[model samples]
Target: MGIKSFQGKRTTTNTKESEPILVSDYMTRNLITFKEEQPIEEVIETLIKYKISGGPVVNEKNELIGIISEGDCMKQISESRYHNLPVDKNNTVKKAMITSVETIDGNMNIFDAANKFLESKRRRFPIVENGKLVGQISQKDVLKAAMKLKSNTWK
Candidate 1:
């Protein structure tokens, strides 16, 4: 047969219509952050007070250094009598937090963000912009994003 129209049809690579989801669009506007020097007790208090899972750890200049989750605190137990001897209360959150942090940008796609969350130990993602903490996103957000994508794609 002669060359069909489908044979010469160009597939559009334009993503303009399929805009990538961003953290700013779905991230929780309420941001909870702890100073690296704050006591772990304070971190616990904040979590219970706000009913949140975790928060980002920042330095004096507001640069993200790590994250602290309730799970981290739950794992801290003393096996020895002195081991039960608590860590120095004076120790900062930096001492207790996972210094190696994984982070996400607000402008990134939710698909990528979700992958990072699932692949790492952290499910809470600190949404940052220009090196400043702006908001947070969790697995819940990722789930919602997936639902949105499923809906949008069909529409």
Candidate 2:
């Protein structure tokens, strides 16, 4: 058998151009966060007004403490209706928010973010940097990134 000479490599210094896509590249920086002590109704209003499904719950220091979603609000509403009690205005975001949050670093690769989303069944995740909320990444963002990648690859 004879060895065949391979000659199909491109000699271009575009390594940076092909760098892995990161979560920060596609994450939404303009986030609507809720205060930990804010009323749940306010959180609901914010979510509805922005047309978003959920948001991060932060403290006075702008540090992410939990996450509040429409599901949480729906649960409260259902419970109140079942119990025949009027909606409680004293309910705070901290009361209904999930304390244990799954956060991702901004530098995480897009593929990793996608896998995390699939595993967690969460629609969105708060992007953290140095324990501070920097931005948010959602399933839509991942899809956009993937679409962009597909387009680029096809070209």
Candidate 3:
């Protein structure tokens, strides 16, 4: 007897490459948008009503022009107080909105998006497609994606 083979047949494990998870898969499509000419009071009201920190500012054609946030509103308020003027409807979003905005592509990988958030210290990033604002990806979205894929390989 040749030492009696007792082990069963060995099988090769399949190691196929899975498709990369994209930002569009987890981005929020229906976003609360603001207008450049919109009054600061209205924007503040909307922010409070919606419980959102900030929103994108659009033009008449619905193109992304800038972003407005609570910080921007605070700046306007501080300026008003310094100048002894009331924060009225005359103060528009255009005056407080950040014109130099950074946008991300929807097709980007979720991991890359997370890295972007870390590098920029941003809570959210606007997703633009074909010169139009399509959606937005936030840190929470990435966390959700990570939780959903917890059972799978992160790579």
For each candidate, the alpha-carbon lDDT, in order, equals 0.77, 0.90, 0.89
lDDT, candidate 3, 1-155, per-residue tens: 57555776768989888778899999999999999889999999999999999988887776889999989998998888999989876999998999998999888999999999999998888887777888888899999998877768755
- Model 1 lDDT per residue over 13-92, tens place: 76766677876688997677888778777788899999988888877777788888887655442322256676557756
Clashing pairs in 3: none
The TM-score of candidate 1 is 0.72
TM-score for each prediction? 0.72, 0.87, 0.87
Residue pairs in clash, model 1? none
Off by over 4 Å in 3: 1-16, 152-155
Give stretches of model 1 more than 4 Å off.
1-16, 77-82, 86-88, 149-155
Query: Can you list the residue pairs that collide in candidate 2?
Result: none
lDDT of 1: 0.77
- Looking at model 1, report the run of 10 residues with the lowest lDDT sum: 73-82
